[model samples]
Every structure is written in C-alpha cells, then in structure tokens.
Target chain A: MQYAIIGAGPAGVIAAETLRKTDPQGSIVLIGGEPEPPYSRMAIPYLLIERIPETGTYLRHSPDHFQKQGIEIRQDRVTAMDTPNRRLTLSSGDGLQYDRLLIATGSRPIKLPVPGIDLPGVHNCWTLEDARHILRLAQPGAKVVLIGAGFIGCIILEALAERGVDLSVVEMGDRMVPRMMNQTAGNLIKRWCEAKGIQVHTATRVKGIESRSGPGFLKRVTGVLGLDAESGSANALGVELDNGHRLQADLVISATGVQPNSEFLKGSSVELEQGILVDNRLRTNIPEIFAAGDVAQGRDFSTGGHQVHAIQPTASDHGRVAALNMAGTDTLFQGSFNMNVLDTLGLISSSFGLWMGVEGGDSVEICSPEKYRYLNLEFQEDVMVGATSLGLTQHVGVLRGLIQGRVKLGQWKDRLKRDPSRLMEAYLAQNAVL
Target chain B: MQRSLHIDPEKCTGCLQCEMACSLENEKVFNIAKSRIKVFTFHEEGRFVPYTCTQCDEAWCMHACPVEAIQLNKLTGAKVVNESVCVGCKVCTIACPFGTVNYNEDSGKVIKCDLCGGDPECAKACPTSAIAYIDANWTGLDRMRSWAARTDTSARA
Candidate 1:
C-alpha cells in the first residue's frame, strides 16, 4: 500500500516507523517542510543556551534506519491534497498517489497583530530556524522585551537572563501563565522572577513600537507605548506611572502561544475547530486521511471533550493511534492528561489533571515559605483530580498514575488530606505487595 | 583553590535535572521553571545549552546592590542574596551584566545562585555530567588537554 505522510516531526516520524514495523511491505513517503532530520523541538532552548551540543537533540534513529525500513523521506512541503485523485502535490511540483495519508502538520506560533511586530528583532520560538535566528541576536548585554508571561516566556527568561542579557516581560493578564496556573502559583512565580532581578509587568498592553534610524539601518528600539493599570494612561519609553515606569528593549520575543497549522487544508474536506477533528480511532472526516499531534483535536479523556493537547507525550501517542488504524488494526487513543512541568529561575512547578474545577471541592495545601516549599491538591467526589507541587516531585509519578488509572480513593481520601506523604507511601507499599 | 561549576553541553540531554535540583534546594519545589540554571535549545542546530550565573570575581550584583543585600561568600565564592536587607529596588538586577540576580515580590528580596552554601545541588544532580563542580583555577584544563591531544606530531613523523 502507498502511504504518504505530511510533516516529519515526532508524530509523522513515529507513525511511519510504526507502520513499517506492522506492515514492512508498505510504501511510505514522509514529507516535511524542515530541511533537517526530525529533532526534538522542546530542547531548542537548551541548544540556544549551549547547555547541550547540537547533535544531542537528533532523533534516536538515523537516516539510514528509515532507508533500511523501506521508507522514503522527502524534505519538501505539501501544498495541496487531491482527495478524489488520492494524490498529494508537493511544493516542488511533484505529485504522489497514496492509498492512505496522514496529516500531522503540527502547530505554528500565534503572532500578534500589533504594529512594529514585523520588525527585524521580533521573533517567535517555534521552528529550529527561529531558534538559530534568536540565538544570533541574543548577545551579552542585549536588551530583550518578552511578550506573554506563559510557560515558554518564563523558560526563555531563565535561559536568556543567565547569558547576561537585559530582559523585561510584559503580560496583558493580571497574572503570569493565567491559563495554566492559578493566581496563587502565578504570584509565587512572579515573586521568584522579581527576586532574580527580572522585571515583570502585569496587566499592561503594548500599543506600538518606535524605531530609531542609524547609519545604514535601524539602530535600536527607541520606544514602546503601553497603558499602565494604576494610572490608566498611555506610557511611552520609560513611561512614568503611579506604580513605576516602562522601559525600552533591543529585541522583542512573543511567546504568546501557538495554533494548529491547518492552513494547508483550508479548502480541503478535513474539518477543523482549532485543529483537525479526529475520532477515537484517530481518523479524520476523510476516510483515507488521518490527523495527529498539535494539528489534531482529539478527545480529552478526563474532560470527555475535544481539545488540542500540544504536549509532546500526547503528540507521540496520537501518532501511535493513527499508525494502528492505518495498518488496518483496531486501536483507540484514550486521550491525554493536562500535565505541565515548568522550570523557572529557581523553582520547579508541575500540575496534572483538572487543576481548576467547580467550587466546594476538597482542597489540601502545605506551604512553608521559610523553607520555600508549596504543595496543593484538589479532590472532587473523593477522587484525586488535580494536584500541584513545588520542590517535591518524587510524588508526581504516584499522583499521576492514581489519577490516570482512576483508582478508588475510598478510605485513603481522608488520609491523603491529613498526611499526603504517608498516604502515598502506604499506597506504593500496597501496590508493591500486590 | 576555589572550585566552580564546569559545563559540557555535549553531555547534556536537556532532562532538566540541574534545574530541578536547584529549585528544590532553593525553593523546596521540583519546578524547573523556577530553577536558577536554565537549559536553552537550538532546535535547528540540534543542541541543548545549560546556562547559569558564572559567579564573577568582581561580582557586579554584590557591588551594585544599594542596600548591600548581595554578599560574596568567601569560602564558596558565591554571591548570596540577603532577603532581610533587600528592599527590592532592583538596582543590582540592572547592574549585573548577566541577568542572574532577580527580584522576588513574594518575599520582597533578590535571588541568585548561592552555590547551595558550597555543595551545589545543580552539579550533584546533573545526570549526564553536563554540569560539574571542578577546580576554578583549572577550568580550562579540559579544553587545553583536548587541543593538546589533537596537536600530536606522530602522524607527520
């Protein structure tokens, strides 16, 4: 059978490999817009900071491995899909027919519509090329302006700050990582960043940018316009406000977030709501077509609703599910847990499952500001649903399993609220004996 | 001789063990997002680079601190942030060429690498030996040795 896969990312690469393992005789053509081989996008920041060497981020399998598995990888972009003709047109003007096709276009960074955003130093960290460009501009003492106080933005702050760069963060929301973290956790992080000398501005909007002309080009960021919350007025570069003032930066990075890269399928038959809608079996509306990764909006097992999970683990699992169905095997993707692990200046925070739900849920918190330890857990109907931990991550594995396995809390529910560590030990001991 | 943390980026896998260890030691949480040491990745280049405060001999953070909240520990050669004395003016944060020193709003103080009071947890928890505590004087010994090995004249002879 002829199999054509768009995107050579983790999802597409894994799907091709799985298909080769299941059906060795099948003809597979893997197409990707990126010129290089498949690499981990999550590790891009480390590469910029010189924490890990370039070759360390390469995928487990070499290029020869794919060749040995009878797979052909074409480093090109997929321009259009002719479902009726069962063929795909490439940007190189090449057409290939296939019995089955996988749409794993993945995601692109969400760009803001503000003026001066298209300037030279503005960047969005998504692709490898984007990382390289950012690295080139990130010199020691370079002033940086980061928009959006989300996970990516915070992580970048930690990395760039170490490199001796002048950095400032602007968040439109009242709190950092407003979507993923609660106000309490956000406050803690805000405190931590401030303690480290990173200036964080919350509840501020960037109206526009001012460019200064140099000998042959624009020298630097002349000014930035934003409204201060306290004064409720426009603030220019070094804008004086009731609270403080705003400053200018050399480079501006927008970690605003990302959306599914489904633009290629705009006129296609594939249905999309944020991403390509996929069934439990990972099949798209088109019978022969399938979607996975950030591009595929699958069911959230915990919520039982369709959502785009942009986590690495989910994208890999989506690939496996799509592969199983493509190989004529019946298998279902159970969905993903909303798990996030963040590493900031000197804090480690991780949360899983339904972190925020309806009120009246049993909540347990252990905080020791003197020791800088904080932990919170939320339970609904006597079951572990959401949990957050700082400093203590050894408990994450057990807690994650308990939530994922849907184990009965029973008598342990009360014990957990009182003494979680002891309860976790008891649960682990019981599991070991069983 | 005092020792400093040596980093070998090639050995790093971006597991964030150093970040976790740092945060846990300083903040008592396993959140990498709060760790002092950060790992940056250049995806297209297939690299992972871990960066942190180099603990300069001059120590700009310590000197720039208006209230003298930043102090250098003689034994550990680390600049420690004193929360009690700090007023959160953020003068040191701007003064430090490397943006290592930062302000924490929760405690109204500044935070930086304290070397974990001599036993740095980041170096200890590094799984791949990417970050290691070694003699400060011989920080360039490893690089020199590698280059010296490449200069062998046996091939020409």
Candidate 2:
C-alpha cells in the first residue's frame, strides 16, 4: 500500500507519522510545497522574534527523522489528483500512484483587493520565506503598517512590536480578532495593544497604498541600480484609509486572513464547500481520497454540522484521525470542539463551544472593562454550553469540564447564574466527566 | 472506571508534601518546580487550593496539542505528555484555561499531572487527607450522598 500526503505543514507531517506507525512499511511519501522541511506555521512568530533559528522550525529536529522512519519527504506541490486512478500529479509534471491520499494542504493568507498590495516591502507572515523577507524590512525604527487586526494579524503585530518597529494596525472589523472574540473581548484586546505602544485603528479600512516619491523615488532608483537604497525608500510608501487618514510606512504586512488551499482540488471528483468536505472519518466522497487540516471541513460540535476550523490544534487532530481511518482501523472522528485561546500581548482569553450563546439559552456575563477582566457564560437548559473569560487563568478549565461533561449544573446552576465565579465549586460538586 | 484523584481544599494544611512527592516520584528530584500538581496560596483569604490535571476524556490540552504529545492512558485515564515528542510551543499552556499544563524550559516540554503513571504520590503523601485517590465513579458519590442525607430530615429529628 502506498500513502501519499500533500502539504508538509503540521497536518501533513503528523499524518505521515501516524500512517507509518500504523502501517510501518506502506511506502509513505510526504509531499510539501515549500522548499524547506516540514515546519509548523505556528513557529513563524517565534522565528521572527529570534526565539529559534530556521532549522528549529523544522517539524522533526533530527536530520534523518523522516528517512529513518522510511518516509520519503518530497518537497513538491500537488497540482491535482486523479481519484479514480488513486494517483497524484505533481507540479513537477510527475504522477505518483497511491492506495490512499490525504490532502493536508492548509490555507494561504488572503491578500486584500487593494492597490499596491503586492508591491515590494509588503509581505505576509505566513511561510518561512515570508518570515525571512519580513526580518529584512522590519528593522528597528522602521515604520510598519499592518493590515487586519485578526488573530494572525495580532500575533504578527506582537512580533513587530518586539522588533521595536513603529507599528500602526488597521482593522476593518469593529475590534481585534473579531471572528474569534466578541465585542467586549475584542475592544479590550485593541486597548491592550494600544497600551503596548501599538496605534490600533478599529473599524477602519485601507483605501489604497500609494508609493510616495521624493527621497524614496531617488532611493529606489539607486536600489534598482544595484546600490544600497538605504532609508530613502523606507519612507516612500503611504497608506490611505477610507477615513481620510493617510499614514506613511516603510513596510506593510498583510494579516487579513486565510482561505483553504484546496484550489488545486478544483474540478476533481472530491467535494468542496468553503473547504474540502469530509465526513466524520475524514474521508471524502471518494473513499480512496481523504482531506484534513484547514482544508477539511469536518464536524463542528457546537452546531452539529460541518465547519472549517482552521486552527492549528484542529489540523493536528484531523491528521491523526484521518490517518487512522485511512489505515483501515475504522476509527471515527468525534467532531471538533470550538476551543479558541488567545494571548493578545500578555492578556490571556479563551472561548469554548457555542460561545455566542444559543437562541433562547440563558446567559450570564460579568464585565470589568476597567481591569480588562470579563467572563461570559452561555447555558442551554441546565448545561453550560459555552464560556468566555479574560484576565483569569486559574480554574478556567472547569468551564470546559462542565461543558464537556454535560454536567447537570443541578442546583448549582442557579448559583452560577447569580455569581459565575463559583463555577469551580459547581464543577467540584457536580464532579461530572463525560 | 479507573480511580481518580479527589481533592478537598478544606482539609488541606497548606503543606508542600504533594509537590515534593510529585516531583520526586516523576523526576527523581527534590525540585518543586518540576512538580505537576500546584498549590495556589491565597494568603489574604487564608486558603490554599491544590490543583492538577483532571484528565478529561476529550481533554483540551490533548486536543490543542499540535504534536499529540499529550495522550490519554487508557488504564489510568490520565493525559500523559510524551516529553520526547513535545516541541514545547506552550500552546497547551494557553489552551488549558485552568493553567495546570505548564512549560518546563529545561526540557522544552509542557508538564502536567500524569497521576504518577496511575499510582499518584501526592495522594499517598498527603498527611491531612487533603488529596485522596479514590474510585473515579464514586468521587461524586460522597457529595451526592451528603445531599441525599440532607433530604432525609428524619435523621435530624
């Protein structure tokens, strides 16, 4: 049996490892689009912050980790797949046959439809190569303007701040990390970034990027002539916003968001929603092929339907579950929990399950915007279905415990409705685990 | 069901024996920093809260772990971290809203209460019976029994 996995991100690497463990000599071939080793995108921020070297981003530290496992690590992208024949056509114009194929191709950062979005000095902090380019331009005292204040953008914003760059963030959303966090939490995070010397503009949009001439034009002339342009072009870029505000920037980083990298799977027999649609077992409509990672829209626990959870943890879990089923172990995926934990700057916050609260569901919230502390709990019937908290880490897992266990809060449910801080006591008293 | 650790904060004496025993049992050292179970001291309130990993069936730590470094031991039902496999990204630390999963910089791995591979040393070392390893199914029985006893007013009469 031959197993071919696409995209050497966390999902691809883990799926390869799991397949090898299940079927040791199955002729496993791991394919990566990038030239580098299978590295975690989560480590890119650490790379930018100088926490680790380029090699540290490699998924397996040992020089021959994959080779030792007899897994062929191919640094080539999959242009398309032929499901009926169970073969993948590579970008290098080669075809490889496999009994099973796992599409672990993750997503790519979304570049906005604005002018000068692709100009030099503008980069997306998604890949290692992007990190290398960012490291060169994000010098200290360099004016950096970041687009989008979402999760990816905020994390990159933190790293840029650490590099001592004069940073300004523009978010089209009303607050930061809009999708992951609610309004209260989002606005609080924006304020937290502002406190950290980051100028955050909420509910803002970039109209266009204008390349300014003057010293910058002369510098670019010298730069194109193979001479050091130096700081001349550094101040040559200007960002115009819909709010009639113009800001000068040396570098612009786009962190708007990402879309599933399932474009190559287009026109294939495999199904595609916002992502590649997979059943609970991570199997596509064609049993020979499967998809995981951000590309697979699996089960969403909160809604009991399919949704694309593009988080890292989901990618890793999907890889393992998909590999197991692919190996004929007949394992079933238990669906994904809506778990999101964010550490904006230094403040830690998390939201689990149906965080936005269910319709006709009872809810409770305690907000102290002054202290940057908030707790919002959502309950359906007697069960706590979701919770969101900020500035409190101690005993927060109890919220998840209650939800996962479906622990009947019993009489303590009323107590929680009164003072939600007593969740720990309720968890202990109910002491339920499912 | 496997046995689970039952903690009673009222019975705790603010002792550090659990920490010492935990560190010594797992790491073979006397360093409290290496201990998985932590006791938070609320000096102003004169209360000490001892906390450890609950090892939930679908643990967030296990789910959030990108490397599958955190696994569930079917026998003990404890979520154990495979140190060798862990990249020490500390995502589990943040994923754990309770803050039980902590990072050890020396090993570049996140350490959590593994219940000492089934036989927990903290329960054995507790002098005041603050921490007890009991049947997992019946940890809640005592609370339920107490509530039931309250419903029986004949005993009070």
Candidate 3:
C-alpha cells in the first residue's frame, strides 16, 4: 500500500514514520510547504531569542534518512486534492496517486483586520520567516509594540525585553492569557510583567496603525490608536490613560493567534468547522482521506465535544491514530488534555485539565505575593479535575497524570492541596498493582 | 573591557532556555515573551538568529530617551532602562533603528536588557553556546578562525 502525507510538520512526519514502521514495503510520500525538514514549532520562539542554536532544531532524521526508510519528501504545497480520483495536485504542477492520504497542513497565524496592517513593520509570529523578520527589525533601544497577549505574544515580549527592546503589549482581553488562565492566574502574570517594567494594556481595542510616510522610504510606526478602558473614549498617541492610549513603536508584532490552514479544502467534500472534522478513529467524512494536527478537529478530552486545533502533543497523538488506522491497524483517538505552561516575566504558571465552571467543586487557593508563588486546585466529586501553579511547577507531571487519568482521590483527598508530592505518592502506591 | 552578549544564530535550537533564564533572573518568571534577548527564525532558510541590544558606543536609545530612562551601564557596556524614573513616553523606542526598545503596559515603564548586572543570564543559559560573553574587541574572532582554518591545505589537498 502507499501513503501520502501532506505536511512535514510534527503530525505528518510522525504519521509517515508510523506508517513506515507498520508496513515496511509500503510507499510513502511526505509533502511539506516548508523548505526545511520537519522541526518543532514550539521551539521557534526560543530559536528567535538565541536560547538554542539552529542546528538543534533540525529533526533527528535527514532527507536521506527518510529516503532510506522509503519515505519520499517533496517540498511543495498541495494546491488542490481530488479525493474522488485518489490523487493530489501540487503547486509545482506534479500529480501523484495515493492509496491513502493524510492531511496535516497545520495552522497559519490570524491576521488583524486593521488598516495599515499590511505595512512593512507589522508581523505575525507563526513561521520561522516571521521570526527572522521580527528579529531583523529589532535593534538596540527600538520601540516595539506587540498586539495580542497570548502565549506567542508573551513569549516574544520576554525575549525582546531581554534584548533591551522597549516593548508594549496590547491585549483585547481584561487579563493576559485569558483563554488559557483564569482571572486569578492572569492577575499574577500581570503583576509579574509590571515588576519587570514591561507594560501590558488589557481590555483595550486597537483602532488602527499610523505609519510615518513621505519620502522614498523610512516607513516606521508613528503611533497606535485604541480605546482606553477607564475613560471609555478615544485616546491620542503618547497620551497615557487607564483604558487606552497611542503607543509609538518602531515595529508592530501581532501574536494574536492562529487558524487552521484548511483553506485549500474549501471546495472539497471534507467537513470543516474551523478545521477538518474527524471521527474518534481520526478519519474524515471522506473514506481514505485522514486529517490530523491543527487541520483536524477532534473531540476534546475534557468536554468531549468537537474542538478544532490543539497544541503539538495533540497533533502528534492525532497523527498516531490516523497512521494506525491507515496501516490496517485498529486504533481510536482518545482525546486531548488542555494544558499550558507559561513563564511570563518572573512568574511561572502552569494549568492542566478543566479548571473552569465547577460551581460547587472543592477548591484550594494559595497566594504569596512576597514569595511570588500562587497555587490553585479544583476538585469535582473528590476527583482531581484541574490545577494551576505559579512560580513552582515541580509538581506539573503529577497533576497532569491525575487530571488525565481521572484518578480517584479517596483517602488522599485532604493531602491533595497541602502536599501534592505526598498525595501523588500515596495515590500511585494504591493504584500500583501488587 | 566592557563586554556585551554575542549571539551566534547558527547554534540556536530554539529551546528558549535563554528566555527562561533571563526572565527568572530579572523578572522572576519563565516568560520568554518578555525577555531581553530575541530570536528570529528564517523557516524557509532553516536559520535561527538570536537578536538583542548590541550596546553601541553611540547608543541612540540613551540619547533619544526624553527622561533619560535609558542609560549606558559603564561597567557592562549595556544601555539599561531605569524603571523608576521612566515616564513611559516611548521616545527612545521610536528613535532606535532596529526597533529593540519597547513599552510595558503593565509596569507603565519601558524595559531593556541590563546585562543582568554584568553576568548576563541569557548567555549562560544558552545550551548550545549560541549566545556567549566574548571580548568586545574580538567579537569577530570566530569568523577569522574559520577562514584561517579553510586556508590550511591539510584537509583540502
């Protein structure tokens, strides 16, 4: 049998590798839009900030290594797919037939719909190219304005601040990382950013960007207009107010968020709601064609509803399920656990599982501003459902397992809040089969 | 003998250890989004470049800073941002050509690399030695050595 994987990202690569292992005689074609080999997307921020070297980002396998495994990697974008014909047309105008197809196109950054957004200084942090451009624009003492207070935005903020770049973050939400963390956790991060001299403007909406234009060149960001929260009115550039104000910046980066890159399948028969819809078996409505990674929408582990797009681990898991079924092996995609580990400014914050909407759930909150530590745990019916920790994230693995496994609290219920390690040990001992 | 952190982008793997170390040392968080050193990746080119304040002898951020919030740390040769006196006017942010300086909305003050009081945590934390503290005058020594090695006939001939 032959397998064709569209995308050389984590999901596609894993799927190809898994298929190769399952069927050594099978032919595999790995198509990727990125010119380089598959690498970690999560590591892009660190690469931009000079934490790790470029060589370290490359996958363990080289192009030749894939060839040895009988996996053909074609570096080109798939413009269209004829699912009925069992063939694909690439941007390079090549056609290939496949017994089975896996679509793992991943995601593209969401662009802001503001005027002058197409200006030279505006950038979206999605690909390595975006990182390069953003870095090139960053100089000593340059004014930088970041739109979006999400993970990417916050990561860029931390990196730039360390480089001596004056940075400003404009978040539409009332708190930083609202989607990932609750107000309480958000407040802790906000305080940390403030302490580091990084200005964070929340609950403010950006109206448009003003660029300095005139001559042949020298186009730089003059100011940003937005609504101030306190005054509830339009604010001018450089005018400081509670809600909004104009910020003059040399470069403007939009780390807002990303949407699944499923635009190519617009005319196709694949079901899509933000992303390609897949069943628990990781198969799309169309038989033979499978979708995974950011492009594939699957059931949420916590909510058990159709949710589009998860992080890297989820994408990898999706790839495994898709590959197993493709290789004639029966496998079901369980689901994904929503987790976030963010270290913003001086605050290390991590959250796992469902920490929201437990009306009468048993809860424990620990806050120590002087020590810069905060911990919050929520339990439902004597079972660990979700947890949040700031500054000290040593017990993340223990918490993650408890939430993922839905382990019984039983006698260790009281010890859960006070000593996470001890409670984890006792729980493991009880669960360990003699 | 003032030294600045030198970055070799080719060595960067994008682990973000530098960002974590810098934030922990300065802001006490693992937030890479607010770090002083920034990394840029050219995905198509398969290149990762870490960028930060070069701490030029004639620093524009220091001169353009209206309230003098940006000052040159004579000991470390870093253009440091003083949070206490900073008015958050962002004049220095616009003046710099490289767009390194930024305004912090949370603190209402501008932030920049202060060289971690001379022992730069970013350089130390870089696992791959992508970032290093080298002699300011001999920053190009690595390139020189590479060229010199290429001239040797032992391997080529």
> Which candidate achieves the best DockQ against the true structure?
2
Cα-lDDT of candidate 1 = 0.69
TM, chain A, every candidate: 0.90, 0.95, 0.90
By TM-score, rank the candidates, best first: 2, 1, 3
What residue runs in model 2 are displaced by over 4 Å at the alpha carbon? A214-220, A224-232, A432-434, B1-51, B54-63, B67-90, B94-99, B102-111, B114-125, B129-157
Considering summed lDDT, which 10 consecutive residues are worst modelled in model 3 chain B?
A: B148-157
Q: After superposition, which runs of candidate 1 have C-alpha atoms over 4 Å from their true positions?
A: A61-63, A214-246, A429-434, B1-157
Model 3 agreement with the true structure over A285-403: per-residue lDDT tens digits: 99899999888898777778888745765676678778988998877666756666665653656676787637778777787877768777788887878877776532234455566
- Kindly provide the TM-score of model 2 when superposed on the true structure, using C-alpha atoms: 0.84
Name the lDDT value of residue A420 in candidate 3.
51
Better of 2 and 3 by DockQ: 2
Q: For residues B1-157, write the lDDT of model 3, one tens digit per residue.
A: 8676777767899888888887788777888777766665444457666655667553545654433356777788788987755544444543343335655556645677788889998898999998899887756434322432332111121
Best by lDDT: 2
Model 3 misplacement above 4 A: A61-63, A214-244, A417-423, B1-157
Query: What's the C-alpha lDDT at position A147 in model 1?
Result: 84
- TM-score on alpha carbons, each prediction: 0.69, 0.84, 0.68
